[model samples]
Target: MSGSRSVADRSRPVDGKRVVVTGAASGIGKGVATALVQGGARVVLLDRNVDAVTAVADELGATAIGCDVTDEDQVRAAMRGAAEHLGGLDGAVNNAGIVLNEPAESMSLVDFNRVIAVNLTGVFLCAREQFPFLADGGGSIVNTASMCAGIVVRPQPQVSYNASKSAVVGLTRSLAAEWADRNIRVNSVSPGYTLTELVRSPELAPQHEQWSSLTPMKRLADIDDLVGAYLFLLSDQAGFMTGQDIVIDGGYTVW
Candidate 1:
């Protein structure tokens, strides 16, 4: 915000970085976007929920768009808008997702497909669209996979969710390899049970309690706990890293 700042002060890992975050209207998306803006990144917040995203963006002095990641046209359009707002893209966070806890046998195909579309296909679309904008400068992409990707020991059934997230790990690796030549880095952050609005739901209380108990930390992770990993991956600090899944599951998958 001031021109008197020195280069080092202005060039902090996320400082002045142009980034796009999906699902920025609420929950984890909202938390990450807030952190980025505070850390000096110019963020373009995208979400299907127009009203909510607009409000949040305005509050943070960031740009906002009402676009669905599942739609190619909207994804392209959102990227275009982001470029216009931030001059160009430097990084992206594909954090848009949904969850359905139901028996695999009884889960309707429609329900399973919906979760995959948002959690899996959505990330693919966001990354693909943002690739062109980021390729010129060689940037970073962080997708939100879950501890469920590796551990499915919970009593509740999340077959579809687990399957989709596991695929994200594979997806991150493949993209990292392909983009490495362009100086682009791709990675994922697998968060443990976090205390977000969604996770704190009355319906999810039992699951939260169970996960909290099982976690080695004996407590759930806060959204802020996962921000450092994203910032590191987006910054030059992780210049040598790519195609890696940084698991921040509070040692949940270690056992």
Candidate 2:
């Protein structure tokens, strides 16, 4: 009881925190950033699309930085910029990623490597750069993984995506362990197929029924459904939690 915090403190843990979110121009990243701002956190939105991200940042009253996560130099600059904008960093969401639905048998090496570079290596670069800013006060880092890391989805042959996401889980655990002494908590959120813009496109709309039928919840997740887990990880409520993956897949992986 001596060290316990009030319920209000735990409930509004992310208020006044300085947080950065990558790939924030759309989808899950945008949803998380919006939530952070609404929760009273100073947020910086980062994405390779400068115009789009800047627009979103302006709309949300947050800062924006154009950063291609796959590029180390760009990632370093973006992290520094975010730190400067917010005075320092308290949390980071490494959510930049890509997926290709190419068949493994005929997938070009270039295509495979490109996915790895963005999805896996990009996370490593962002986390590595964020360490310096977060090390000072013991911050949290949340990486975006996928339910595909545990089980492959049907009707799609995305070997590269599956492989990259699986590695993200491993990377999250490794970083959490290595940085525990520095008091930097690292964790991941693995969301099942969400109805993001890409997923809502005409090309993929036909597959929605198939995807929904596979989930025990009988539906896909909404961006709102997944942002709460990210907010929790970034808050002091999860002070002792690290190196864990919160899978929000509507029971898709259960089967």
Candidate 3:
């Protein structure tokens, strides 16, 4: 106990950290940004939906940037802008992603490539651009993967999504190993079916019951349920962790 920090000190692990979150217009990204702000971190919210993200940032008293992660130039510029706003970066959450539920046999190449461009290549671009800002003092990068990365779900043919997410894990491990020397720890979070705006839509609501029953917890996760993992990955408490994926699936993958 002589060298130990108090629980109070440990409780606000991300306090004063400079952080950035992509896809911050809604869903998990917005949830994480809100938590970061509440935890006393300086945050920059980026999303392709400029107006929406701007509103969220304004509400949270954080900076906002219009960025499309799949575009390299945009990613680079957004990172620079975020670092400038934060004065430097301590952590980043690369969470911009889209899923297309089409069977592989009928899925057009254009559609498949779109998913890869955003979910896989976009992550690479963000991490690459964030390197310079973080290299000086070291930082963390949390990529949002999905439980689909590990196992294919039934009733949905999202071959592209599954493939892209699986690659994210591989990318995370590669970056973690390569950047360990620079103190840039890389990690990923793979969430199970979560209750996001899109999921609550009338078109997708019918599928919720099936998804919930399959989960061990008998329900979908709230955005709140997954934000803690992101906060931990970006905090000093997880200082020794890297190249790992924290799956927040409520035991869905346990089977």
Candidate 4:
């Protein structure tokens, strides 16, 4: 068998599967959606950025719905909207998050709450709404966590971001355990400093060179590089894997 043949075989379809991806307008969420579509799942994009979400859905021929995940009502409505648009829902990726840099001593309550609202509360909202849709036949869920959840950060502070993401890991484990008998698999992916909008911030740009050098891969990850783990968790390949956190950091956490 040729190498090309093996590659082609690996690209098999995930037909008849339905997936909802929040934060689908950009970054890692967008990449995950694209990969699901390529693998033959029908995808519904939920994003607070209506225009970008619609544009991406149009480009991918998937359905798009406007949603502010931090709001319970909006999150419920968005989940319903996606279920209706896609005819059903089988899986979800809770990838919506926000980050704010502040020294712990100086971090205001408002800033801290904002990050927690979107990164942590948003996950709760989505998972709460997803239950009814996913319970029947069981389904998969993958949350976007961060390397900061497991490792310490230095030089730049994201105390709020780190705390919220750590909650995500806890959420994944609890949900996975609760839903295990029901066959609803739950997992999380923790990424290190990857090439995303967050990395281009003026505050963090100076550290990019250091971050890259620190990684064993010696490069920042492309958003797409995280897709395979998602596909696995959503597929039978990882049917037995749940309540786990998969770290994809280009080996940045090894040291």
Which portions of model 4 show Cα errors greater than 4 Å?
A: 1-13
Model 1 vs. true fold: TM: 0.94
lDDT by residue (tens digit), candidate 4, 205-247: 8888888888899998988788888887877557679999999
Q: Which portions of model 3 show Cα errors greater than 4 Å?
A: 1-8, 201-203
Off by over 4 Å in 2: none
Q: What does the lDDT read for residue 216 in candidate 2? A: 98
Better of 1 and 2 by TM-score: 2
Q: Tell me the tens digit of each residue's lDDT in model 1 across 106-128.
A: 99999999999999999999999
lDDT against true structure, model 1? 0.89
Model 3: per-residue lDDT, tens digit, 132-195? 9999999999999999999998787899999999999999999999999999999999999999
The TM-score of candidate 3 is 0.97
| TM-scores for the candidates | 0.94, 0.98, 0.97, 0.94
What are the per-model C-alpha RMSD values against the true structure? 3.7, 1.0, 1.4, 3.8
After TM-score superposition, the amount by which residue 14's alpha carbon in candidate 1 deviates from its true location, in angstroms, is: 0.7
Ranking by TM-score: 2, 3, 1, 4
- The lDDT per prediction is 0.89, 0.95, 0.95, 0.89
